[model samples]
Target: MKPSLQLKLSQHLALTPQLQQSIRLLQLSTVELEHELERYLLDNPLLERAEDYALAANAPTTGDGEIAPRSDAPAEPSESASPDEESWLGEEAAYLRQPGSFDEDDDDYHDVQAASISLREHLLSQLGLMTLSGRDQVLVGCLIDALDDDGYLTQALDELAESMPAELDIAAEELQIALIHLQHLDPTGIGARGLQECLALQLQALAPDATRNLALEIVHKHLELLGNHDFQKLKRLTGCDDEALRAAHLLICSLNPRPGAQYSTADIRYIMPDVVVRKLRGQWTVNINSDAFPRLKINSLYAQILARQRGSGLAGQLQEARWLIRNVQQRFDTILRVAQAIVDRQRQFLDHGDVAMRPLVLREIAETLGLHESTISRVTTQKYMATPRGIFELKYFFGSHVSTEAGGACSATAIRALIKQLISAEEPTKPLSDSQISEVLGQQGIVVARRTIAKYREALNIPPVNLRKSI
Candidate 1:
């Protein structure tokens, strides 16, 4: 080994924090981008959501010349960020520029609710209205804590009692009262022990008889058998005539098994398309959503301010300004790449319909786009594809395939689609049996199992044979 030091020049790929943040923001869905921006605005007093800077997309930026707003959707201007070069935090990044705000967009927060409060919150609010002693309030508090995300109390009283603080002194009777109060809340049937109990609470006001009793037994004891379509066990256990059992089953089916579902705090975020696809002169063309990316420019106003008074940390300030420029550019570039990849693979879906969708796996797109698999996954997860077939999650295009008669690959989704059509077109007086549907698919050389057909039907949220049968 040579001891003397020699001049050497080497280059290595290093992901600086600013670059990493750009990459992360690049792939976020529109809603995710909004949430992230909101969070950053909260944390950084300097950054804002571009409320007054109406110049967002409509404003002009220096790079790539002037981008006009598309007739279909206008672009947004970049967010407000500081050009002030603090000694340490130094220069901040400018947001992506856009053509302008769309003429069609009208803020509608006045009507609909954004993701509702958790079941516990709803219950606690209702609980407060009740006149309870201090000890009773403590017990109710413990019960509220026991509720799961789905709003069921999975833990046994023993476990829950031990988990609670000693001051609560939650006994079984006290717990029962709290449970009653929870059930009585706006979204009924919450705090139930299991699916059976949940449904029972919802149906409590119903008179107990052959029909109601059958439902209780079916939901409580034979729910497993019913799921498996073990008709033999159901016939023996319920001990009702087939017609009576059928009625009972229909009644049970109408109940919401997870009552807390209506009040779920989990955000059911609406999908916003990153790209818009339309058939232009019989050919499918993709348009990247220029709306989401506002026209961002390094606030020359702030830049002029900083340029005149170059302080001691001039190098650091310049680096930040440059870094912000690169980050904004990278964000647009990454979004473009992902949008192109989606348009490339999902053309068939746009041309004909979802039934014509090609088998598009995440890895396939990731490899094609020269992006990491996880990166592609993140880009696609919670992301949507807008087409002539309407909007669908990116995940919907990728499905397991089965061989077809013409020696072509067929998608499980296509098979399910076909099954749904067949079932839907069938006479209500004569529903197609699962086995019969399986036979039909086999004759067509699709070769799906009867069990598989059942699974698919269930996945489509269709009821089984007895439920499907009608008067």
Candidate 2:
């Protein structure tokens, strides 16, 4: 066979570095974008933050065209300014001069965060003040260490004693004594073995009375019945009247099952919405949050040097810097476009709350904006919108739909909101069951299955009818 060489041309899609960067930045949240920019700023000398340049706007330039260090003193307003304008400018200057102002570089600016102390540290502090011998203190401290963040001693005393050194001669009874001392800490339920014991400990801490005794007995023995809202069984077993049972139930409800939770360090995440939705002139308007948008610009000094020297080593870096700045701006622009589209679609939700939310999906926004579904997904992934109702991730607006009897569709989110409203208005003694809720929706022409009602109810953290019942 003769070998023949022929050239064939075919086109395939490829992502350029700039396009890849734009996609990546579009998917990142506000905090993550800031972190990504910090990495870029550290690696690229031709990139600088716009905030720094603005802060040094009044400073003199050096021979190399770099801005000189700014002085600590505040700049004064011009004397030629009008009296009214001067007064306004003076007030603005005073605000900017205050501690913890918007200026991150201000020496006196410090974020005020509540000091958090862990459960173990709190228990140890209480132990330190107690009049106990060294050995007793060590044993109590060991027990305190074994407690979980919820203040429950999940480990068995026997297991704890066995895990200790044999030479130390620790026993389960000694650990029990230590447990007793540890339970006497400021938080009443600390060192409890289980929910029943935790509640019992809290109940026992209260002064002796008929209600307290009944509540303690209920916690120790009939807790499961109480949890199931089997009020009849509780009454028969505890031999208490409806009024007494209700009072005891109220007392039990006031006790915190997780006493140590107050001290536990919570991982609180803050969201910076990329866009803010507001009702202006009877129209829902979307505006980009200036703080959430990253302000990036190329280093003018390096750019100037590259422009004059034509074949400088920084030319590649200069181009990269320009690409990043443009890409970041494009990222926010795409986000704003997508967000505005979402706000436009969800205007009913903003006006009348979640129950009025219309069914939406990424495809609708993508088609409206002339973008791909994947692009819309990326734009909404971590991007948030601050609205009158609250801050919600853009993805929250898009949900699957349920068909109604009238040939219309209802959003699952709207259905959930309806279920929540119905349950909130239900009588405590006879809370609406899943089937009843489903029927209520059915009567409204929106057919939702009992299982779906249960699912949405659980998602909303509402208990079942059996558990929601009260005396």
Candidate 3:
């Protein structure tokens, strides 16, 4: 080690508190932004919602951007202001003017009735109608609880009986009877022990006919062959011709595999778009949703107090409030700019459909906006744009470039859309294979490999030709 220190000078990036806050705010989604603003309002008294700003004659209005010092004088009504011009906190003020006012249509506060009954509740209600001994009902309820969310009783009757309390005296045979009764409940397949049993339960609920009997046979023995789409094996095993097999296949397809899925407890997510795109005078326009961003402003009263008490620990709070406001404004401004650039590039997609989408990359928008590619990625993530067609994520506009024969690049999104269109119009008996799709695209002057087509087809959820083919 050298005893003497050598002079070294280097420059490296440093993220200041303000810069860090700005970067964090830039990455937040609409809901997250609102929560962050709420936190700022709670933490910093100098910051308030924009709707909370109320001006009076007695309160000094600084036109030079300097905060006024606090005075003993009380605020007086402005002569020029209307007699009924109320503050945002006023209860009787119009909601449009009072941004902090509670929304009557807000489902978060109001109790929304359950859309549908739970599987247990549905089964219990049906059980109430049936004349059963309380002991039997208890056994049925235990079996109902044992059934998984997919309406399949995964546990065996003996296993279920063993898991129960010894005082209940529920035998395996009695539990089996209870399960049979439970299976008869609405949704038709509630308590079946397996897939075959579930399908058989559903078949039994249907009217007795040749199609129903054929479906029963297919489900009972050839369910595996049917699942594998091995029509030839099903025909050999069931001794059914193509016509009968097709009818039975259609019947099986019509049945619900997971009968209890209708009662799933998962919450349905609601998306609120950040940007709205529309056409005016035949020119596409992008508008940032003001409602999605919280309305914030510096509290003039607190600002004045802080001005009087400068360098008394309030300066940092004031600076923080200012930084938050600036960062929030910059965040939305950057989002709007990025969204506008995207709309300009994806105008064809808006005009037509996904098929018209041009190849787009994050670099282009980042360069156009004079921002880093990572910044563009952050802007696109968790941000949605509402267009005339439907709402889409900002990232939906960006896709890998696929070159056409004419030396032009097409978006993978557009190619996928094209593949979907071709498959939708394909003959069921002779569905287009991935190679055939690539050939069709080549015919249209778009050069795409069979494997690429297959990848795109799988992404679109279009099954392979064998799986897609109907008898």
Against the reference, the lDDT scores of all candidates come to: 0.63, 0.81, 0.78
TM-score of 3: 0.85
Q: Over all chains combined, what TM-score does candidate 1 have? A: 0.61
lDDT of 1 by residue, 20-51 (tens): 88777766767777676666545433233333
Lowest lDDT 10-residue stretch of candidate 3? 87-96
Best by TM-score: 2
Candidate 1, 244: how far from true, in Å?
Answer: 1.0
Ranking by lDDT: 2, 3, 1
Pick the lDDT winner.
Answer: 2
Q: For candidate 2, report its TM-score.
A: 0.86
Error of 1 at 17 (Å): 11
For each candidate, C-alpha RMSD in Å?
Answer: 10.3, 7.1, 8.5
Per-residue lDDT of model 2, residues 1-471, tens digit only: 999999999999999998888888888888899999999999999888766433332344444334444464444556765564455345435534552232243222345454378888888999999999898999999998888878899999999999999999998998889899998998998899999999999988899999999999999889989889999999998789999999999999999999888887776565666775655446666755545655566677777788899989987887777777777767777887888888888889987899999999889999999999999988888888766567789999999999999999999999999999999999999899999999999999999999999999999999999998998
